[model samples]
Target chain A: MTEDVPVKVNGLNHWFGKGEARKQALFDVNLKVAGGSLTVLVGPSGSGKTTLLTLAGCLRDVQHGSIRLLGQELNGAHSDLQRALRRRLGFIFQAHNLHGSLTALQNVLMGLQVHGRSDPVLQAKAARHILTLLGLGDRMDYLPDNLSGGQKQRVAVARALVGNPDIVFADEPTAALDRESGATVVQMLKRLGQVRGTTTVMVTHDNRILELADRIVTLEDGRIVNDTAP
Target chain B: MSLLLQALFGRLPIGWLQLTHNRTRFAAALAGVAFANVLVFVQLGIMNSMATATLKPYGFFQADIMISASDANSMTEGSNVARQWMYQAMADPDVVAGTGLFVATVTWQRTDKALGLTTYGIDPTQPIFLSPEMATRAATLQLPNSGILDRFTRGLPRDETAAIRPQSPLSFEANNITLTLYDTFAGGGGFGGDGFMMVSDQTFLQQFPARSSGAPDHILLQVAAGADPDVVAARLRDLVSDKSLRIRSYAQAAAEDLSYQQTKRPTGIIFGFGVVIGVLVGIVIVYQVLSTDVADHLSEYATFKAIGYGQGFFLSVVFEQALVLGMLGFVPGLAVASLLLWAMASATTLPLAMTAGMAVTVFIGTVVACSLSGAIATRRLVAADPADLF
Candidate 1:
């Protein structure tokens, strides 16, 4: 692996439960993601795709091997280090996870605020710019409850991108959108990654998203079965 | 609220957002806090009333120092101190004048109800009343079997007030003791008695034939100009070899009586427990609201954790909510308690005012209670695992 790779995973393993119920979730997973590459983890259920994504994102403890995110090793990383590293990353979960009491613009701003402090005016401007890019310019003040399912999912995507993170981890990013909105969000993610050198590692089953990926790593039963760049 | 929180922390008030999102839950939580505040305020007010009532009789005198029987626990309940103590106190150069005070709680029958009339028996010659009007009015007790009644007594009827004036005396029989009310005063009712009446030493002895003139319940003495009452009292304590008498400055006696009533009386103990119960109820209610809220958004909290939000940020939100509930709830609770206390003071003639000290204490207590509940409620949320959010 090159020294400049943004995400480098070597000999990674994971397990769940204890004693008689203990079961392995991943087996010696190894991968290197270059800067600005859109790498899609494609696998069936229980294939440990999410487990690898979380380990690489520094979202969980690395139980067995070495995983470096943004040149810092994740194994035995202190909480302050993990937290500082997390500030440079973004995430899009399947559930959208928008705060019900906050408006669309506020939810998007939360993405930027985790980095400590910034100009509130600039933060709002950046959030508005991102929300508008996702075709939610008019719904910026609407709470999550008032938004439709597709609108909420688009807002989540906007939040993950508004902070201008160096890297983004997404799970089923376009699962709730219609074809037009879905295509728009996918195009935005691709443009941001390619032009701005924002690395993206996503666990997705969307065929359109997979086709546009710079690299695809397929997994079955916790081990990578295929890797191709085409 | 969001704007206010933003101003304070310059960050998203996640706690305020979560609380306000569910309108019903927030209102219920606030109401719980308010109820607790009201409970504390009212109990404190009742305790205040106990002290006020216990020291009511002390207000009737202008003495710099007082001598009571050692058996006296409060101003109202005591046996007798000999009149010779008064004569002994008057001899000192610091002592100008003194009076022997005889007290007896007599049961008076008012048609269907029985009331306690605390009758003060005093010498017509010596002055002890704080009120100049009362001192003049008390002189009328010099007339045979005549006395002055407390017009502000709790159960005194409207018709009796009109009938018992200085010009028109109302003759009545209390416990087969003949007494004619020639005047009235402003000393209100208290826990010690439903009313009070003053009489001459001769009339008082006639009313209680078994009692003697040599021994009175208490002795009140006035000190000379610019002399400290405590110093005079100390001098008297040294001069009087009687170990069975309690000698102190009048102010010290009243202060001790107030504390004794508040700490040692059954009313004080029961009201103190009321305050504790109120705090506990408040904690439970707030905890239920906050805990349910945390549970409902477990997945979202896990997502926040994954998004690089620290435990401190989350805790800030919950504590902000706690502070909001405490401060806002105290407003309505204090207002209601004030109105109730004022009404009670007039209707029952107990000195039950809502003091500044009581208000400040209850306010701090409310904030602490709500914060404690918030801390307990956030226990599970702080442990939210970002790994399981998927």
Candidate 2:
């Protein structure tokens, strides 16, 4: 599990616009995420935590840094290469972002569909298995609108993990859930990271789940202020 | 390939479901598309109806060959030919039978009622090439003072008994023509309103005092079996050396009639412009609706991208949605246009024929518009960053 870095960002700096409009979103950020570990990034509002997470997730263009996930450099990748790289990375957001028209099971199956996998039976089976693991077995047929907030987040988590990506990036996934549901989601994410041996990076403002993370990184302004392993 | 199929077909149901889920938005979009179709189809139907009405009178002339002046492009602008031409045509060995006819617009009055009517002068004794039904009508007609009034004008009483006020002075130089009713020809109206009369040459000259020299407008000829109409037409052309006189077979006349309608009448041009406007409106509406929907669900698209959905998959969804909306709107629009055409047929003398070709053309046009709009609107999805979901 400790053999190599799952995500590496070298002197990453990102700014929005130029001149007077220029504002640094990420500043001289350098970090390494070890494989098969649950890393939590905690920060206050406007701390540029999301910017750093987006850069590491290959969702944004780097202005003055190098970013590599699973040893593939994303600094100058073409559009197609970037898409391929994105297919190998799973992302979860504060909102479920589940297709309101699709059922929970279908939402999970969409993960495989995004990767251009068309085997519906296999996809369905994997989706069901993931939902069951996430304690959402009974809600598979419910649409996002029909499910409770906690169930919606769980479905989103299942969607992220269903693709079997090398790394999972979650941005405030538990922000919209109650305390108990948030804890359950964090615990489930941690368990999946350990069992699947996949790197998990979750950005959150909730400190209650800090003990559940294998490592905690705090962000102040746009730089990492503290890194602690427990 | 399977992935594309699944995304195209499988995602289609979801897209439709989403559309249906939002009843208000879906209805608005459907209404916009349907209105566009209605506008296009109605304009086309009216154009067809006008063309049909203009050509209805000639439908009965079954002669394989006809000769008229080259400048007489349509029924409205035909030129006069001498009765001697019919006799000259009959001299050909291949000529079976021929007749001389004159068509003109004339003002008629009985008592006080006066109106303009299309008047056809034909020799009733000869085997005229006109429809048998019209011939029967011509045979049964009673010419008052030697002039026969068509069924359209027959409702008016004779000049002696009628009490209606005349819009024009009643003039009967040689004889007074009494009105008589007969069977009506469908869509027989000419450039003017739907009132026409048929009469003998002598009665026509009597009723129309302005025609000091009576002349037939055209010659109708019937070729004997095994006789080539082209050869007879050529001979007629050679005999009539004056450039003002040109010979045309019935086929040539029909072709010329179509060309005249296509070029001279504003019906085709106006309707063509209508169709273009409909297509443009459809594209704009479709683009706006689909673009809004895509923007509303942009996050979901990003999530799909994050999970690995290809750009092709996103594009397929947009296309499927467009097709669904187009089809949904098309069926109702066609039905509405057909209803309007039927209602119009009853109220007016125009003949509106909605053919399968028209339907096919309209459907193809709608589909193309929708597809183009969807393709343009989905460009944002292609440039979207999947990692934005994080």
Candidate 3:
């Protein structure tokens, strides 16, 4: 509940298939993520880093053990509770899954719209404000089809942060960006953690991002092999 | 458009935005829906016109009540009742006049186009016609081998129908006997024939040598002024000792005949199946479009789920798109159908019209039909898991 730990996991396990084709993804994993801190999950392909991130972010059903996210148990929870818990969270995929038909501004507005925001004038204002901060002020009216890869990723970033979620879970948020933009994005997350007490958990293999992480947790073959505080 | 959408749904019209995103697909889907609408409208139009045509001959006669054999089914193709029923019906105080009309279908040769003309043979002596204009025209048929033709008949020579007056008569050979038509009437085509022909009882005998005047196809009775036709009809039923006669008010008999044509005929069944085919075509076309769109945007929908948008939200988007496509397509479909119906009505001289009842029925039917397709298309998106997107 305090700044020491906002995300606590105990002996969490998850599987991918069933019966003869059953396969395990995570096994007896345990960790605590401090509030207002950037925790990075780094691993090679099929190393279970993405699996652990999605499990902790409420993106998948927690199969076994307990995961207390923002003081709420997620294992075997009702769908209503899961959806309510998800509303207070944010997610950024590596592909930047922005709606192709929506403009940059509308895409950001969707972040707030899921929470059933009623005020149109203020919602548009807030959406515009966040897009402007992401250096997409001139591209607010441009559709995703009209934007480049890096620009579309920024729109996705603006969409995730516009709602001011309690915690952000990103899977390679900067993969589609150049060095300067990726550096700017990581700095923005770091600055938000210090100024607004917003927690961020990202899974990435970017070397430049490793230098700025407050803590690094690496997974290999479905188990934590190394944990370090930089 | 936005205001209408806001009234029905919320301010953010996500469905409309997504449907309008791909211009080519939207246009194609709209056209498909419109084509289906046209198919349905045309079928319903023809079916409705048949209902109206079946009752056309009833308006030509001037009877307050009619008597036919109890086993009779419709105006045409029914057993002929004994002519003694006319005298028995006239015994009532409300019975002012009566007539024995002989009706039968016969083929007439026009030197170019053969016509199936329903012959209504009367004495031309009783008050048997509703309009004085028709009565005046029928009076000319009293002469031997003389008759009047229906100008409103389909496929009739336009100038010939107009020129064949008393001064300019036209002769036609039919049933191996030549008859000359010296006048015309306003009666149109119906289920019995392509047109109507007025003849004397003697001429009707010549047309059908075996049909005796002792029995007529129907008995028409004219009740006294300010008297209830229903009351006189009921009295006739009791006074007539014949159990084979079916006495009914003029309006009631025509209504029963129309219903009989709509429900118990081969043409009715064909039109009903035609309507079913049209609806099925519409559902299949809309399903293809909506299912394809859902497949293309699977990842985006999964992202919405990751963002906590529920299954209900996705349903609304697809349903909204369906409603928009159906309504837009119906507008053009209605316009095109009305024009075609107008042209058909003019050529056939039937009471084919675009009514408000018909429009409202099609509008509601299309909406419900398209929504069913939309519901089916969303089943795949419901199964898409957010975990798979990572």
Candidate 4:
């Protein structure tokens, strides 16, 4: 019932494939993420860091054990209920998954549209405001194909932030960005946490932004081996 | 209506945008759909024209009821019916007038083309066929070796058809006789014959010289204004009581002949096969286009699913694309079909015309075809799990 806890996991387990080919990806994972703070998950490849983040973000079904997201238990939850929770959270993928055909502004507007149908002018204003804040104001009309790699990732950040979601789950959001752009994205997330009480769970191995995190959870072999305040 | 407009052009234009984004792919899909539409339209058009064109000669027959040889299956296959059947049909109270006509096909040689021309021998004194040209030239056919040539002959030389006037000599090469053309009439040529000539009974006998004089090919009867032709025909059938006579109202007979041509003839079957092939081709082409589109956009759709957009939203987008293809594809199809039909009609003198009903039917048919393809292609999108984003 604690509203300050944005995400909590206990005995979390997940597997990939089926039959004899099946392999366990996560085993006995446990964690708690605080509200109004930036929590980064650090781990090597195939260590189940992305698996735990996606489970917390409702991107995949919780196969075993309990995951409480935004104060609602996700274990055995109805698909519709899970989808409802997903709308309150934002996701930024490792590849900066913006539609190639859509303009920068249109890509941001897609975030707002998924929430519900609203006045188009108001939606456009919101999308424009987020892009401006992310330093993409000048490239609002440029399609993803025309934008550089760093600019495209910034647009993805703008899209994830346009809806003002309660929580943001980012998977390697800065992988495609240069030092300045990567720092800009981390600073923006920190500002959102401080100003709007938004919670952020980012999965990244970049050490440059690790110093700014309020807390860091390190996963090794599907288990959280380290949890410490910076 | 305003809400629907917004759905189509505003909030829901994602389908349109996505389709239009790849210009080459969009153009290719439109071409595929249009080709299928054209195939169906032309096949149905020609089939419809065949049924209508063959009825052209019957349109000239003014009788409400007709008596033909009992075993006769179609207009061109008339056998001998004893002349006594006509007199017997005239005895019915509903019969106001009656006439007997003889039909035979013979070799016709004009300066331009040599082909078989069907000849109708009409009693000069009786009102046999209702034709504007015949009203003026009926009696002229009573002269020896005189007949009226049909003006609208199939594949006839345009110049010769125009130049042959009254008193023009037409050689009946089969009988070694040359018949003088009394005049030209409008109705007579179609599937029934390449061309036709109307002559008096005496002239017909002279031209053929082999046909029996005592029997006629068919008996035409005019019913009283208040009497139902079906009832009159039934009465005439009973009155004649001759096993060799088959009596029917004009409408019933024409319907029978049309049904036979559409279902039993090779031309009709070929056209039906063409329509089936058109639909099959549409399925294959549209399936390829939509399948490729879904495959290209699978990741985007997975993102949509991950972001809380339900399966219903993506499905609507796909169907919207289908509807656009259906409607836009029809434009080129209709344009091309109308041009082809005009050319066919001019070249063959067939009664082919595009009706508003035909356009609407083909458009609806195209929508159904494309929608079916879209439905099949959407399976890939539906199987896209948001888990792929991880």
Candidate 5:
């Protein structure tokens, strides 16, 4: 384990279901992601791209092997340890799951609350700053129901970044955005890596943004087929 | 205060936000809580009033101890006892004073309507009962066939003064004997009937016609100035040779009466039933509201978990919603129940009032009910796996 490696995996395997219906999703996966680097996991659907990402991101329990995230081993970790590790990480779901009841700024502020930030003024300023940078400055008060799909996705990005997480794990973050918004999001993630030493691990199918990734790892049939450096 | 506000209303006002996000759903949930409060409060109020009414007649007399015929289960069923027993009990030096009480039922007949009345025999000069309203007019009862009626009787007109003393010295027939109403007092009637008329023993015997003059129904005894009633009552039992009489302190008697009302009467059973139903209804409504809210926000909750929030955070938010519903729902329910209780008291002449104890009881009950509902509804949220959101 080196200080430059933010995420490291060895012989990780995961299975879904039980008894005779059990089927393996990822098999003996091994990888290492560098710190302050934009790493993208690219593969067709059901090819273990998501399983590996979720396992390394602490969203799923590591079933068969070791996952060391930010120097903490995640195999059979304590619940409190897992939760503490999760606090230093951020996630953006494919569906862009923003709370419908909250305004755009409120949704972003939720990210700060999970970290136990109680200052309303400071939270609002950080949330507003992120939303403004994401090109949602005018829509800060709008609810998810009232915002466009692109604007809603941008809000999710702002929420993921507002807490100043050490690592960001995104699943299809740019799927709902236009070309311009997509470029802007990728640029923001890249800039965060350069300026704040933040690491990003994303699962994507976008071809145009693949060029921006610091490293691209491709998988097939739950096996890593190619690991390329840009 | 500043810190408290920050704790409740800071960066994420999640509880208030979730509840008020949908106006229609929030209003419906509030209505459900208020409805439950009204049911519990009204039924409990009526039940309490009924129990109080059973012991009310006894409450008016200032006696340290009371003696009733062993066969007399309640004041409503007072039977004639040997007056010599009262004289025997008074032989103890702890006994300060004793008075014979006469209780009998009579048919009261006016112009076109007839009603039942409980006639009481009291020697007004002995100060056996407390009635300040009719105190100044006590002399009127010394006149033959004259008695003071209870103003709390149900059959009387709303404007009782107009019908009670209308010119010709208001006379009514009791058991076919003419009795004149000399004054009205503000004591409530017992469970046996809607009216009471207090007269002297001579007047009671005349009204009953068949009753003997020497046999009184009950005996009320006052203890010596510094003596304990329970001890004196116990001593009286040993002094009196009659093993068939029931002797107890006034407090003991009231407790016995209340216990009987609770165990043997339908009012108590019905009120208990109403309380069960109210709690059940509250649980269902709150569970439905919280369940649906959780279902709607399932993915969002998972997002919270994925972003590093623990189960405690989510539980706190849901419980906060429950607390809000409980408090907001209680306000309207208490107000409505208060108005309804007043109307019921006026209409039924029962001693119903919104007591402070009742308010606190119902408020605590509402919060507990809502909290239980919240706990039940959060099963799915707590069991949610953040991996499912993928």
Candidate 6:
């Protein structure tokens, strides 16, 4: 795992449809994310930063580019391989899309359950431990509707980390939080990537938190324009 | 497989939690299902009750064979057999006993009041296989023009010396007959209403002067023990080459009656339509319900899909929800049907019995309907590209 590149994208181009209505969402994007590194992508709205992250995460279908995660080429791979990529990748969204019907702990355990794990007690314990580490130890039984904004985001972070994914993708994860809560979330993500050796790619418009990134890449339009780290 | 099962059953708590979270929506959906069930079950119950009412007349009979006019296809209208057919039938070694039966519609009177009724004329000496209650009542019944009156037709006595004044318009004399409401048979023969009378042959002839020629309409036969009715019936047909009369074993008659009900009556057609409607309604409702629920949780589903949850897994969850609703709705539907049948049975002579086979059939039908809807509704999840979530 130490020698493996967590994510690599080269000349990735994606279009929505055919004919005149076709619109390019990502264009000639090239980037590499090293293992155990915190990479932040900063861009304006619709700058394709999220598209780049999704492409690297194997969440979107790539049309005209190559992507390799953990030494496995995603382009032209079988459905099973693609599924394996998703299983090993963790994703966090800004909205904290936790299920309203499930409690905070159950939402975290849902990650493991989705990956076909059947041990309820083990899943529960792992989810509880992750939530506890994220400062949500007392809110395990709280449903999404019952949780505050900051608590919900923490629960979402717990869910992303519960499976111990090789790579974690966070898109504007702190956009809905206040300044204090947002800083705390950024610190937690930095520690997760730097201390635990989990490669993390975050897309955000908040440049104030750029200092927490091990490497920061700037994107304009759909291509990377600058990089602060070699 | 175990994981799938766990997810399938594990979702029950989630489903309940969601339902409780929104009580109004849950109640609305449940009510929709319950209403659909009630419509289907009530329609089916009516059809079943109609069939039972149609067959009730034969239920009380104990004849092994029924010999009617050769062209007679039903009990309502058939050519008459000669009274001597009874003697001829009894003469056969295989025949242990035989009776003449006269069936006709006649107008009866109790002191100037008159009403039409179906008359069953039987030999007083021979046993009437159709209704023993009617047989017992026949003994005490007097001949026509001077006899007892049925509870429905019996009126107060009238003056006997009364005569019409001179130059009055001609008035027809109404036949006075006795009627005893000893037996009440259900009145469903693919027709509208029911009224029947059972009387002795002498009394019937006296009342219905047009039928006085002693020509029996049908002859019922009782086969001797260890006798084959089919063989005896074939032999009888040979003996009576007159194509005017037909002889049929009881089993054949029962089969023909069942076939007639299935093919000729509207019960089968209506019930079949009802079942089709039920399936279609169930599919639409279940599909809409599960599909809406999925759509409501689209983001959550996308999250699961991003975490390697296969299309099959999500499909299973949808199927489980449909099945749960189907089972829940089915229990109440069947219970309502049973209650309706019981109430109908008490009010009318219809026999509405629910068998294990019917229950199984309904259960399978509900499951299949729900599963089909579930499968169709979840196609969106299968084709969903997780990349869109970003």
Best by TM-score: 5
**Candidates' DockQ values?**
0.66, 0.51, 0.65, 0.57, 0.76, 0.52
RMSD of each: 2.6, 5.6, 2.9, 3.2, 2.5, 6.8
DockQ of 3: 0.65
Candidate 3, B-chain TM: 0.88
Model 1 lDDT, residue B377, Cα: 86
Kindly list the per-residue Cα lDDT of model 1 for residues A5-83, writing each as its tens digit: 8899999999989999999999999999988888999999999999998888778899999999989999999988888
Off by over 4 Å in 3: A1-6, B2-8, B62-65, B86-98, B128-138, B141-146, B164-169, B176-182, B200-203, B221-248, B342-353
**lDDT tens digits, residues B1-390, model 2?**
324434658642556766776889999999988888888787777766666656666775567667676677776576676667667777778888877666777666545666567776666666366677666655543344333343334334335323221222123332355443333432234335555655665556666666633356777888889888888888877665454665777777777776777667676576667777878888999889888888877887777776666778777788877888888889888998888877865555356656687788888888888889889989878656665565
Per-model TM against the reference: 0.93, 0.83, 0.91, 0.90, 0.94, 0.81
What does the interface RMSD come to for each candidate? 1.3, 2.4, 1.3, 1.5, 1.3, 2.4
lDDT (Cα, 0-100) at A153 in candidate 5: 91
Clashes of 1: 0
Model 4 DockQ vs. reference: 0.57
* Fraction of native contacts under 8 Å reproduced by each candidate: 0.62, 0.74, 0.64, 0.54, 0.84, 0.68
Best of the candidates, lDDT: 3
lDDT of 6 by residue, B1-390 (tens): 335445656632444454445667766666656556666666666666556645554554557787887656555457888867767777788888877777776664445566455556666666446456545544443333222222222121212102212222112234644333322322322232234455667766776777755577777788988999999988887776465677888667666666666557576677768867876887788788877887787777787778787777777677766676677778877777677767765454344555565567777777787788878888767555666677
* Positional deviation of residue B277's Cα in model 5 after best superposition, in angstroms: 2.1
* lDDT of every predicted structure (CA atoms): 0.84, 0.73, 0.85, 0.82, 0.84, 0.70
Local error of candidate 6 at A220, Å? 2.5
> Which regions of candidate 6 are displaced past 4 Å?
A1-3, A194-196, B1-13, B67-74, B77-119, B128-176, B180-197, B201-219, B227-248, B334-364, B382-385
What is the full ranking by DockQ, best candidate first? 5, 1, 3, 4, 6, 2
Candidate 3, residues B1-390, lDDT tens digits: the string is 755874577646777778789999989999999888888887788878887778777877788898988766677768888888788888898998887878898788666788899887887776454457668776687788898888877778679799988999999888888899999988776656788888888899888899999888888888988999888888888999996688998888888887777777888778888888998998998888888888888888888888888888899888988899889989988898888888988877766778787789888888998999999999989766888767
lDDT of 2 at B147: 35
